[model samples]
Target: MNKWEILNHAETACYQEEREVLVRGDRRWITALHYAFQDDNYLYLAMDYCVGGDLLTLLGKFGDHIPEEMAQFYLAEIVMAIDSVHKLGYVHRDIKPDNILLTADGHVKLGDFGSCLRLQEDGMVHSSLAVGTPDYLSPEILRALESREGYGPECDWWALGICAFEMLFGSTPFYAESLPETYGKILHFQEHFEFPPLAAAVSAEGRSLIQGLICEPQERLGAGGALDFWGHPFFSGVHWATLHHCTPPYQPTVSNGTDTSNFDVVDDCLSRMEALSGMRGSQPAGAHLAFVGYSYMATGETKDCSRDTVMSTDKQQSGDSEGLIRDNLLTESVSEELPKPFEHHLVLSKGPAGHVHGDDTDLDAAMTMELHRQLQEAEQRSRGLEEEIRQLQGELESLRARRLTELNIHEPHLFLPAHRLDATGDGKLAPPACHYPLVIRLHRHLLLFHRVWRPGVTGESYLLVCAAGVELQAWSRQQSAELS
Candidate 1:
C-alpha cells in the first residue's frame, strides 16, 4: 500500500476509538453514534447529523466573538458534555470550539473523541504526545511530555477556559506565531494571560468562571464533576436538572436536517504526505480480531433478515409433489456419479433363485481395487500442494524482512556530533542543536532532506521540518555531511 493508504488506515483506527467512546449511550450533550462498520480500506461511522454546524462556524458568524449570555448557555452544556465523558473514565484531550457541534436548535453536542484516553485507577492518564490543538493545549499536557508525569480530566477544563476566552474576546489567550512561543506562554500563563480592554463589557461573573477553569490543576473547576459547577456564579440561574430543556441563546438557521450551509465546504481531495511509522505494510494475521465485539445493535432494534425471509417464503411456495420428485431425482443422479465407500457391499444383480451372479461379484471386486488406487493418488497430490505452499510462505516472509531492513536503512534522520548527544534529557542521543536550515521533500515515495533554520526566543537558531502535514523538531548541524 502507498503512504496515503496507510494514513487512511491510521485514521480508521482513530475512528474506531471514537466509536468506542460514542457507543456508551445517547446522552443529551454527547453526540449519538448510531452504527459503525468497515468496508474495503475504509471505516464508516453513522452519527447524529448536527445541521446547525459547529461553534467555530458560529464564532465566524458573530465576527469571532459572542455575548456573555450566549457564551454562558453554550459553556454550561459543554461542562455537562465533558462531565459525561469523565464519568465514563475517559479524558477528552481535544476540546475546542470546532468540536462542539450545534444542533438545528443551537444546543451544543460535543463530538470528536479521537484524542480521548481512558483514565487509570488513580484518576490520571500518562501520555507523551501533545494530542490537541496548540492554541488550547493545557500546560500540564506539555509538562507531562517532558516530566513523564500524569494528568487528569482538568486538561479538558483548561480547554474550556480557552474556549470561553475566545468567545468573550476574539482569539485564544496564549496564541503566538510559533508553537514553542505559544507553549511557553501557556507554561507561564500567570504572567502571559490577561483580559484585553476591548472585552471590558464582560461581566465579573463570566471572568471569574474563566479564571477558575484556566488555573492550576488542583484549583481548576469541575474536579468533583458537574456538581462543582452547579453553584458557580456564571451558571447561577441555570437549571441543573433540566439544562437541555432551557431555551438556547442562539438558534441556527438550517432549512433541513442535512443542510451544509452552516459549515465551510472544502475540496475532498487527499493531500500528498509521508505515511506514519509502523503503518506501511499489511497488518499481521488476526489483526481484525481486535474489533470482534465492535458491532452493536441498539436495544429494541431488529437486524434486517429480508434475504432469509424471502428464501423461506420461496421454499414454502414451491412445496409441490413435482418439486419433491425433481429434488429426489437430482440427489439420485449425484449419488450415481460419485462412487460411495460402501458401494461394494451392495449386490446389484442376482440369479432367478436369489443366487448372486458371478459376473456381478467380479465387477464389484474390480471397482473396489480401482477406487483404492485413485484415493492413494489424491492423497499424494494433496501432500505435494501442501509442501509447495509452505515453500512459498517461507519466501514471502524472507522478502518482507529484507524490505523492512532496507526501509530502516533509508529512513532520514539528522546526524549530530557525539558531544551534542548529551544535550538530550536522560543522557540519550538527541537531535542536533537548533538554528540550521532543513528542507524535506517527497520524491517517488522517498523523503529528501536539507537543512534550514529559524531564530528562537533564546537567541539561538532552531530547525523545523514540515512533513506529513505536521511540524517536526530536528537536530542542529553536524560538521560531517552524511545523506544516509
Candidate 2:
C-alpha cells in the first residue's frame, strides 16, 4: 500500500465515521478531502496539515518521559478518539508511538487508521489477519498467530500497554531480533521493575502510570478504563481544558525541514500500504468480500507460504481478468465469506451536503439554555427540601429545651416557676408579687432569668440563672434563704 492507497482508505473511513461518531467540536475538526496520488508511488495526505509533527518526534526532543499530568491530558483525548472509533464498530489494530501525531499547540491526534477492523453485528466468531506493528501485539494475538486461532480487540490493549511503557521508559518492555522471539518474551516474561528505587527518581505519578501500562492486556485499561486511570492522584491539578486547547506546559524540540524531508520514503510506503491493506483508512475493509477475494488464488486454490513472503504479490492473479488476489490460505472458504458492499443496503451518507455554516452561535446558545434550565430546577428542589428540614428541626429543638427546663430548674441556666413568700405560715398567705430587677443591654435585647427560693421564705436562700446568646449563660447567687 502507498500514500494514495492510504488516503483513499482514510477518506472512506472518515466519511463512514462522520455518520456515526465524528462531529464538529469546540476546536479542531478532521475532514477528509479526495485522495491524490503522487508520481513517485507516495500518497501525499493533504489532511488538515497539522503543524505539530508525529508524537514520537515530540517525545524524542523532550525527555523520554512526560509529566503524569501532561500525559493524562494527552491520554484523555486519545480515549475519546478510541471511543468514537469503537462506537462506529471499528478497532484501531495499530496503536503506537509512530501513529499518534500532535498539533502545533500539542493536541494529540490519532492519525493512521490503516489497521482498523470492523466486527460482525451478530457477535459470531471471526478471525482478523494479524496486521499491526509487532512490539505492541497482545499475548492473545501472539497466541492466535502462533496457534492459528481467533483473536479480537484485546490485542489492541496489549499494544496500548506497550505504548504507555515506551513513553515512560523510552523502549518497549519486550524486544527481540525475530518475530517469534519477541512474541515469546511478551507471553512468558514477568515484568519486574526496580520499584521505588527507579520510580523514586521519577515522579510518583509517572511511576504509577508505568505500572499500569506494562500489565497484561486482560488486566490493562480498556475503553472507559483509561479514563479512570487518568483520573488518578498523579494527574491532580492538571488543567485538562488548557491541555485540550493545545496549550502544553512544555514544548517539544523542533526538527528542521531537512530532517522531516528525510521521511519521504516512509510517507510513500505508508500510502501504498494503506491502499493494499484494504481497510477503510480508519477501519477494516467494508466487508469480508475483499478479504475473501484476496484470500484465494484466482483459480480458487490455496497456497502454502512463509510469513514474510505472504506480504508480496504473486503473479498468479495478475493475469486474471477479475483482478482478484487470494492472500490467505489457512481458513476454509465458506459461502457466507463474501457479503455485498455496505452502501447497497445501509442507505446512509455522511458529512456536509450544503453550505449553511453560520448556525454555531445558535447551537451554543441552545446548549447553554438547556444546561441553565436543568441547573435551576435542581437548585429549586434542593432549596425547598432544605427549608422544610430546617423548620422541622427548629420546632423539635424548642420543644425539647422547654420540657427539660421545667423538669430541672436546679440545673444550670434553666427556667424556673415563679415563687412567692407565705406570710401566715399555714401556707395560705399568697400576697401580690411585685416588680423585679430587669437588665437591658445596649444592643436593646432583654436578658430574663429566674430566681431560686426556699420553703419558709422567712430566711433568705436563693439561686439564679441567666440566658445568653441562644444558650444558658451561667449560675450565680445574690442572697440565700434557708429552708424552714
Candidate 3:
C-alpha cells in the first residue's frame, strides 16, 4: 500500500518516452516495457523478461573474446538496433554490453533509455550535455563539451565502433590511464590506431568498418547517418529485413524465467527485485521522487500483475525503499538492502602474444635499430591500453546513473512572440524553450504556465491541460532593476 511522491514534469517526460519506445512493440530490436504507473509518491515500471541476461555477462562466462562468428551476430544485431533507435528520432547515448539484453530464445533487445536524447522534430537537432559510460563515450561528445558546442546522433555510431571493438577484442580501442587521456586517443586515433591481432582475425573488412566509425566526427562512418553504417561491408552478409527471423548465432539455454546464472551480482539484484513484485510495500518512510509510465501486453491490455507477481516474486519482506524502486536498473546500488559490489572483473587474456614482437629472424637484418626501438614502444602503448581497459571496466561497476534529467531542466529562455500565444494571458509562463518546441526567437527569463479549466464535452469529462500563462510581472521588474 506504499507510494512514491512525484515532482518534476521533465523526469516524467523521460520515463514516459522510455515506456512508449518499448511499448511500440517493434520486434526487430525493441524490448517489452510492460507498464509504468505512479501513486501520490512513486513511479513503477514493469519490463519484459530477458532471461538470457546481458552481453557483458556472456562475455564474463567465456573468459575472453567470444568466437568471431558469435560476435558478428551480436554486432550485426546492435547495428539493426541502433538503426531502429535513430528511426524513432532519439539517440541512445549509452549503448554498451550491459544495456543490450538477451532473450531466452536468443535474440537481442536494446533497453535502458535513461541516457537517450530526443532530437527536435523540425530537423534542428540539439545537444545539451555529455553523458554515457566512459569506456564507450564518443570522442565528439567529449570534444563538444570541451568546446561548449552541441552534438547529435553521430555520437551513437562512434560508440557502436567501440562496441564492435569490445566484441571482437574484449577491450576498448582507446583505453588510457585517465578520462582525458582516453579522449585524446579518441581524437587522434584515426592517424595512429590499427587493429590488434585478436581483432584482425575477424576480417580486414571488419577492421575497416571500426576504423571508419572510430574517426573524427566529420569523417566518422556514421556521420552521413544511419544508412551509411548499415551499408558497410562488415555487415556484407546481413539481410536487415530478416535478421530477427534468422536463428541467433548463440542462443542462451533457459530453464525458467527466474534463471540468474548468466547475470552479474548487480543484474541479479535487479532480477531479484523484479521477481519480488508481489509483497511490494507501501510508500517508504521518507522518499519523494517517483517514476511513471504506461504499459500493456502485445494485445494492448494491462497485464495481470496479481498472478504474475505471486508467481515470480520473492518471499523476502519488502523493505521501506523497495516500494518506490520497482526495478534496480542502475549500475550502482541505490540502498543498503542491495548486495555489496563485486570485487573481481572478468578479463580477456586474448592479447596478440608475439604479434607485436615477431621473431628477430623475420626482422630485416639490415633494418635500422631506431625503427626496432619505435616498434617496441608501440607495443608497450598497446599493452598499456589493454591494462587501462581493465580499469575502465572497474569504474563502470562503481558508478551510479543519475535519475534526474540533467539537461535543460531549467527554463532559461523566458520570452516568446506575442502572436504565438498558446495561452490567453492568465499570466502563466511557458516551459523551457530548449525543451518545449518553439517558432519564436528565444529570450532567457522566468515564465510559469497556468492551468485553466474549460468545458470540452458539456463539462462531463476533462483534460488537465495547462490552459494559460501568468508571468510574475513584479519579480521580473525587480530583477531587471537589480541587473541595471
Which candidate number has the best lDDT?
1
Put down candidate 3 lDDT per residue, 171-191, tens digits, no spaces.
887888998777677777765
Considering lDDT, where higher is better, how would the candidates rank from best to worst?
1, 3, 2
Candidate 1 differs from the real structure by a C-alpha RMSD in angstroms, to one decimal, of: 27.8
Per-model TM values vs. the true structure: 0.58, 0.45, 0.54
Evaluation by lDDT, superior candidate among 2 and 3: 3
Whichever of 1 and 2 has more TM-score, that candidate is 1
Each model's C-alpha lDDT?
Answer: 0.68, 0.46, 0.57
Identify the runs in model 1 with alpha carbons over 4 angstroms from their true place: 1-16, 269-283, 301-484
Candidate 1 lDDT by residue in tens digits, 170-196: 899999999999999999999999998
Q: What lDDT score is found at residue 434 in candidate 3? A: 21
Off by over 4 Å in 3: 1-13, 121-125, 197-199, 223-226, 229-231, 267-484
Measured with C-alpha atoms, the lDDT of residue 204 in candidate 1 is 88
Candidate 2 lDDT score at position 432: 24
Please identify which of the two predictions, 1 or 2, would achieve the higher lDDT against the true structure: 1
